[model samples]
Target: MTRRSIGIVLNGVTGRMGYRQHLVRSLLAIREAGGLPTRDGTLWPEPVLVGRSEAKLAEIAARHGLTEWSTDLGAALARPDVSIYFDSQVTSGREKAIRQAIEAGKHIYTEKPLAETAVAATELAELAAAAGLKTGVVQDKLFLPGLRKLKRLIDGGFFGRILSVRGEFGYWVFEGDWQPAQRPSWNYRAADGGGIVMDMLPHWNYLLEELFGGVRSVQCTMATHIDTRVDEQGESYAATADDAAYAVFELAGGAVAQINSSWCVRVYRDELVEFQVDGTEGSAVAGLRHCRVQHRSMTPKPVWNPDLPNSVPFRTQWAEVPDNDEFDNGFKAQWEAFLRHVAEDGPYHWDFASGARGVRLAELALQSAREGRRLEVPRLEVPR
Candidate 1:
């Protein structure tokens, strides 16, 4: 069996999502599994962690027992041996670095909300296409166990003639006054390219389009519920970004979707994220890890009585979907697929064009909110 090592320059991996999800759980986990298997043999990802702080990068390398670490991104990008460049940087900082990487002829993978605006995201996609460099953006939710099960049900015609989708997502992010902030301070600053709409709408865009149909129109309302919040340094700052967003989307097949995302809302659901789909023949609710289904045959019949308490056990009516297959970390699954796409020309559907489309949806939704009216979402065309 032949073995090949693929050198990857990972930028901004010292951050929270970069460190925990992409580096520790995804890349390191893949390395621990003896790398990814390919037709040629095994393709091992040799990652060189790159960040702004030398101390932080060095500490992470030591903690992970990794040999390669660098504080200089330009030098890392200039290296001939590195074939791939991965970025998980702050939204405002991603464009320049990604552009340079594409110029350096490196295949690129990046976190979502590719840019602050759809135009910039589309420009990046066009640049990568012109350069003939492979590019991808993170769409991790599609690979979730529950979503996979939901997909199976959809494919099997379990939810015949799907009608509408409702998604509830969020958890309370403590303000830094009493407890340390759960998220970075920059997430509350509009100038820093932070907002719940920009952060989450991209995920919903792809999810709605992929699972149901293309989004044709959107109506939205965004709010900054908390105007003042203490920062990481214990100093109070004006929160300029939207903390919450309520959006309604009309899909191509006449399906409607309502998704609520907030950073200030308290959790009451079984999971941090949950999506309920209602259809003609059945219904299904999928959380991050669990999925429940209720077919027309097994649905409960209940009679409403205003004067008396309901006797029906509403929660017990739906049947839990069995976990018949092993589920891996969603981030790691995408990473492996991307590596294979880079190494052996494997099939990969989520490309830069797809990422641009996600950004376009967010842009349109924001416009809809600002105008206080439903707006049409035009399709984003990418050159082949």
Candidate 2:
């Protein structure tokens, strides 16, 4: 049996997502679950931690039992041991690291926003194409059990001729005032590639575009709801980035979708992320854990009476989605899939092009919000 030991250079290893998702879930979890299986047997993929700080890197390395740790990013890139350059860096530092990785002839995988703008994203895709190396980005939301069920319903025509999609995504993330911020301070600064539109639009873009339809045009309004936020240092800084964004999209299939994203709003629903789909034959609503469907035959009957304080007739008609062992822990599922893509010739669609498309969509959405006009999505002509 031939076993391939794939070396992965993990950039931004000290960050939250980098440490938790990429390192712990993808690397360490893969090990705990048994090595990635191939047709021949299985493969072992090792991770080398990359960061700018020695202390932080050392701390993470110690925690993770990683023998390889480095503050020098370039040396990690030049090493022959590293076959894959996994980037979980801040949005601002993403482009440079990815470009260098591609130039070094390594396959690449990264967190969202391939670049801050569509133009830069396009360039990166072109370069990766020229190099003939495999590239992928984390589109973890699509792999969620709830969304997977949603996709099944749509494909099965449960929502005959889908008409629209509505999504509410977020929770009240503390502003690092009394408690330390869960996210970095840079995420709320516009100059640092921070903003709700830039950070989250990518997730919506891929999921909506892939599940609902290709987004043709977008109309959006954004605002920095919190003007001042205390940083990790307990010093107040001007929050120039957007804390909230509301976007309405027109899809290629003639379906219209509205998405509301915010860092300030407390979740008033069953889940932190919820999507509601209304179609000609039926309507379905899904949260991260559960899915509910209401069909045409089971549609609710209502008589309007404003005198009553609050009365809705939509409860009895809906049926709850059944639990399945296959669908659980969306992030972990994506990790398993990525490992399969790495070790075997399994289907891998989370490529750089898809990642770039997400960035482009976010870029256009931001542009629409800024100019107070709808922006058309540009068509990409992939090189043959």
Candidate 3:
């Protein structure tokens, strides 16, 4: 067995995403799992911590008992010890770091929205491919248990011909009026690549494509529902980005998808996020962790009475979706897949090309919203 010792340079390891999702849950957890086993029955890569703050990096390193650390990304990239560069930085700052990492000839894995614009993301993807380095972007929602169940149902033809998809995704991210804000302040600034449409459309693009087909066109409207929010410093800042967006997608397979993402909405259901898929033969509704299905043949028909309040068709039609343990936390599952791709030489599906496509979708949605016109999505030869 050939033991491939992988050295990973972790950028943006000090952020909230870096701490819980990347460090403790992914890299550290893999280390605890005795590393990812390769086809030859040996562990492939080991993680090393890198960040901007030496103190915070040192703190995390101490917590995880990791010794390899660096504050200089350039130095880390140049090190022979490092074989992979992972970035979880703010959306605005991801491009430069990833570009440099690719030039360094290391396999790259990072979070979404490859760049602020579609062209830039496309360029980045080209660069990584030209460099012959393996690359992947985080597309965690597809691995979610609820979404997985929905995918299974779709694959098995449970819904028959798909008609439409409706999604509601949001929760109040509290302002720092009493406590510190949970998200980055730049997330509300347009200059910093922040907006509900830019932040969320990518997820829907992949989801819609996976469930139905590629998006042929989109119509969207975006708005800044909250004008001002206080940060941890007790200073009020004017919000310059859209906090809410309503988008409609026309899929190539004739399926329509409507997505509403907001920062001001309150959760009043099974989860903060939910979706309803209506098809020719049946319909289904899925929350963050659960879903229910109803077939037309199984649906009880009833008369519609405006005066009579209650309806019978709704009461007896829907059935609780059976629980399956194949799914886990979306992020964790993607992380595991990533490790497998690195270790076992497994085919990596969510590569840089896929990431670029997602960014393209977001850019197109933003353009459509601003111009008040529908935009066509260009199909790319993204790797499967």
lDDT of 1 at 39: 94
Better of 1 and 2 by TM-score: 1
Best by TM-score: 1
lDDT of 1 at 323: 88
Which residue segments of model 3 deviate by more than 4 Å?
A: 1-4, 311-316, 381-384
- Residue 217 lDDT, candidate 3, scale 0-100: 90
User: Model 3 scores what on Cα lDDT?
Assistant: 0.82
Displacement of residue 165 (Cα, Å) in model 2 is 0.4
Q: What is the TM-score of each candidate against the true structure?
A: 0.99, 0.96, 0.94
Task: Report residue 384 deviation for candidate 2 (angstroms).
Answer: 7.5
Best-performing candidate as measured by lDDT: 1
Q: Write the per-residue lDDT of candidate 1 for residues 1-384, one digit (tens) a residue.
A: 777899999998999999999999998998899989999999988899999999999999999899898988889998888999999999999989998898899999999888888889999999999998888899999999999999989998998899999999999998889998899989999999899988999999889989999999999999999999999889999999999999999998999999999999999999999999999999999999999999999888888789998888899999999989999999999999999999989989788888888888888888888989999898789863
**How do the residues 154-242 of candidate 2 rate in per-residue lDDT, one tens digit apiece?**
88889999999999998887887887877789999999989999889989989988898888999999998888899988999999999
Of the two candidates 2 and 3, the one with more favorable lDDT, higher being better, is 2
The regions of model 1 sitting more than 4 angstroms off are none
